[model samples]
Target: MELRVEGLACRRGEAVVLRDVGFVLAPGEALILRGPNGAGKTTMLRALAGLTPPVAGTISAPQEAMAYGAHADGLKAQLTVAENLTFWAAAFGTSGIGPAVAAFDLGALLDRRTADLSAGQKRRASLARMVLTGRPIWLLDEPTVSLDAANVARFAAAVSTHLEAGGSALIATHIDLGLAETRVLDVTQFAARAAARREADPFAEAIE
Candidate 1:
């Protein structure tokens, strides 16, 4: 699997968040997107996931890709953990939820309501839904949020296994996720790119 973004830019109304951003991730490779608050990290992830359209440039990815946002998207507050997993499995065109349940250590929480689970448990359950997708590429935004050290380790292991199986990931996070050989991109660089473009603009130079 491969994901490539070339000269990508995104805007929310009048504000340009990500500008001229580009990168590539090959199979078994992972890239970590790092930026401070309001630096367009989430925007870039959403663009990559196709949840948000880029204002300029292109995102090239496989047909079967999945994305998990900062929120635990799969956990239904009103549903039991098992039911939540079941619902996601069916949605992802899978036949069984057993593997995802066991992989994420959600066995005990299966019968419990999603609302009853703690924050970390909810995050794990959400991750299980991503796993059930069986997609080759994963776009994760803050995947380790609310996870303890032990669960973080478990999450790292899961990601390692996924990469070993020819899967790829692009993770946007402020926390260290312990993924091996992960590349880091600082979105602040986009500002520099934009400035350079402005400096080279004939109209801007004339105005100055």
Candidate 2:
């Protein structure tokens, strides 16, 4: 699916963080969001993922076409890795976990409870949810957070393969993932200023 955003705006708790943000993500492409901490990169992704309703402008994408990943490593601590993948697959109306397991090298850890996994292992499992979703667009916030150098390479490779297969991704990260379909967007330019707010209806209202 193609993701199109225009004059988009987002907020974090009562403060407008980003405004006049716009970008298009076509099939097989990736956009890297960059800025200092708290610069609204995550906010942009949230709006794009439909978690945070946009404060302004428009976002056009298919319903349920985007999969979101945050720093939290969303997982069922009591469930085994395999069980977790199965649950997500079913939730997304997808029927298989083979690809995800192979993509994340989770074969050996499948039967282990998620709580017992190492941080990197849990991170991989969290990201593997993207595969289970079968969504065309991925919105990932610091996806490589707990990964080691090797796992980072693994993730980069998986993303490369995803793009090759016509998927799109929007990622916020400080380090390079070495992907060829990458484009970098700095969110600092779109920071919503108090002056702009006063001039434009106090543009954003927070979600949390």
Candidate 3:
């Protein structure tokens, strides 16, 4: 399986942050999206995940085959760790939460409510849900947020295992996740200057 993006463009509200971006992610491969802050890394990830529609071009991948993890750890605050994993298990059409539980080291925190867990614990729980999704393509935004060095190593191992299983990952992060064999997409060239142009001349559109 593969994800192909051609002439992709992304907009946040009235501002266009990305334009004419293109990339291909092949099976058993990983792509790291690198850019300075506000350079549209998150926007690109969201567009690839089908959460936000591209203003131009195409993402040639079935929506169901992609699993997305955003900056926010999307957990039900009141639900216990195990319950959260279980909910995602059924939602993503996958069974058996044991592997997911062990994947993120959630054994001890399983019975605890998400609201009661620390930042790292909650982040792990959120990531464990992705394992349950069983999707081939993982679109992660700042996936290593709040994780300690040891936990980061665990995440790297999980990603390695997924790749070995013929899965692909597209991660947008500031810190290195220790993925040695990965492609890098620097989005600086794709940054849309239209937003700044519009700011300089509000009436520029009508005159042109």
The superposed Cα distance between candidate 2 and the true structure at residue 90, in angstroms, equals 0.7
Q: Which model is ahead, 2 or 3, in terms of lDDT?
A: 2
Query: How do the residues 111-184 of candidate 3 rate in per-residue lDDT, one tens digit apiece?
Result: 99999999999999999888899999999998999999999888888888889899999998877877756998
lDDT of 2 by residue, 98-190 (tens): 999999999999999999999999999998999888889999999999899999998998888889999999999999988997899999878
By descending lDDT, how would the candidates be arranged?
Answer: 2, 3, 1
Q: Report the Cα lDDT for residue 101, model 2.
A: 94
Query: Which of the two, 1 or 3, has more TM-score?
Result: 3
Between candidates 1 and 2, name the one with more favorable TM-score: 2
Error of 2 at 191 (Å): 0.2
Q: Of the candidates shown, which would achieve the greatest TM-score relative to the real structure?
A: 2
lDDT of each: 0.80, 0.90, 0.88
Residue 62, candidate 2: how far off, in angstroms?
A: 2.9
Winner on lDDT (1 vs 2): 2
Model 2 Cα shift for residue 56 (angstroms): 0.6
